[model samples]
Target: MGMKASYVVQPFELHRKRLRPARQEAAQSESGALKKAENLAKRMPGAAALRIVADDETGELESATILEAFGEVPDDFAESLQGG
Candidate 1:
C-alpha cells in the first residue's frame, strides 16, 4: 500500500537539535578523559607518557587496552621538544 502524505510530512514537521552535556557530564565524557590525562601527566612527570594505539574501525577501547609506550627519552628528544 502507498503511504499517506501525512506520514511523509511528519518528519519535516520536527526540529532536530544537538544536545551538549552538562558541565559535570561533559567532564565525565571521553573528550574530558584526554584533559584529565594531561593534568595527571603534569602531576606525575615520572609516570609513563600516555600512549594509545587503535586499529582503524569502530567501537570502544578500555583504559587498560591502551598501550603505555613510555621510558627513557632519547637525548635529542628533549631538545626537539624545546624547539631547538
Candidate 2:
C-alpha cells in the first residue's frame, strides 16, 4: 500500500458576509503549513481566516482523509475527520 501525507493551509477571504477560498499552501507538517498560511494571510489586503488541515493518502490516490484540523475550523470539521 502506498501512503502519502501532507499539511495544507487553506486561506479564506470574507466576501458578502461569507468566507471563500482565496489561497493555500501544502507543507510537510501542520505547523509549517500554518506558518506559510499566516504569512500569506498577512499579505492579503482584506480580512481572512487560515485553516490548517492534515491530509493523509489512504492508499487511494482519488481520496484523502483529514487527520486533524486547526485554526478557525468548522464545528463539525474535526468530528467528521474523526469519522464520527
Candidate 3:
C-alpha cells in the first residue's frame, strides 16, 4: 500500500464557555498548520486549546500543543507515538 502523509491542526472551541475540540485542518507544513490554528484561536474568542498534529499513512502520528489553557491532549494522542 502506498504511504500517506499529512499535517493537521485543530483548535479547541468554546460553547457556552465549555471547552471542546473542533474540526481538523490539513496544512502544508507544521508551522503553517500551527499558524492556521493560531488564527482560528484569534477568530474564536472562546478557543480553549490548540494542537498541531502530523501523521503518516503508516499510522504514525505526532502532536504538539500551542495553547493549553486546560492543559489537555487528545485521548489517543499517546497511542499514536507507539511503534506501529
Candidate 4:
C-alpha cells in the first residue's frame, strides 16, 4: 500500500485537427520533467510536465498534477489528465 510519486513529460501532436498525446517520457525529478517538456514543446505542438502519485502495490493512480504547460496545449489537458 505504498504511495509512489513519478514525474513525466507528455508531448502533444496535432493529428487530424485534434491534439493527441505522443509517447510519454519518464523524468527523474519535477525540474527534469519541466525542462524536458519545455524542450519538447519547442519541437512539438505542445508539452506538459506532470507529477503523478499512485499506489505502488496496486498500480492505481491516486492523483495527477500539472506542473507546467508550454506552447499550444489542449484546453482540456488538465481535465483529461485527471480523467474528468
Using lDDT as the measure, which candidate wins?
Answer: 4
Q: What TM-score, over all chains together, does every model reach?
A: 0.25, 0.47, 0.49, 0.93
C-alpha RMSD (angstroms) for model 4 = 1.2
Colliding residue pairs in candidate 3: none
Q: Is candidate 1 or candidate 4 better by lDDT?
A: 4
Q: Best to worst by TM-score, what's the order?
A: 4, 3, 2, 1
State how far residue 66 of model 1 sits from its true place (Å). Answer: 2.3
lDDT (Cα atoms) of all candidates against the true structure = 0.26, 0.49, 0.51, 0.94
Q: Total backbone clashes of model 2?
A: 0
Per-residue lDDT over 1-84 for candidate 3, one digit per residue giving the tens place of the 0 to 100 score: 344544566555656766556776667865566566666766654222334444545554464544433233445543443532
State the TM-score for model 2: 0.47
lDDT of 2 by residue, 33-67 (tens): 65666666565532222233333444333334443
Q: Residue by residue across 1-84, what tens digits does model 1's lDDT show?
A: 222110000000112442211121112333344455444445333112322222335323222221121222233433332352
> Which candidate number maximizes TM-score?
4
Candidate 3 C-alpha error for residue 19, in Å: 0.8
Candidate 4 lDDT over 1-84, as tens digits, reads 899999999999999999999999999999999999999999999999999999999989999999999988889888887783
Q: Worst ten-residue run, lDDT, model 1?
A: 5-14
- Overall local distance difference test of candidate 1: 0.26
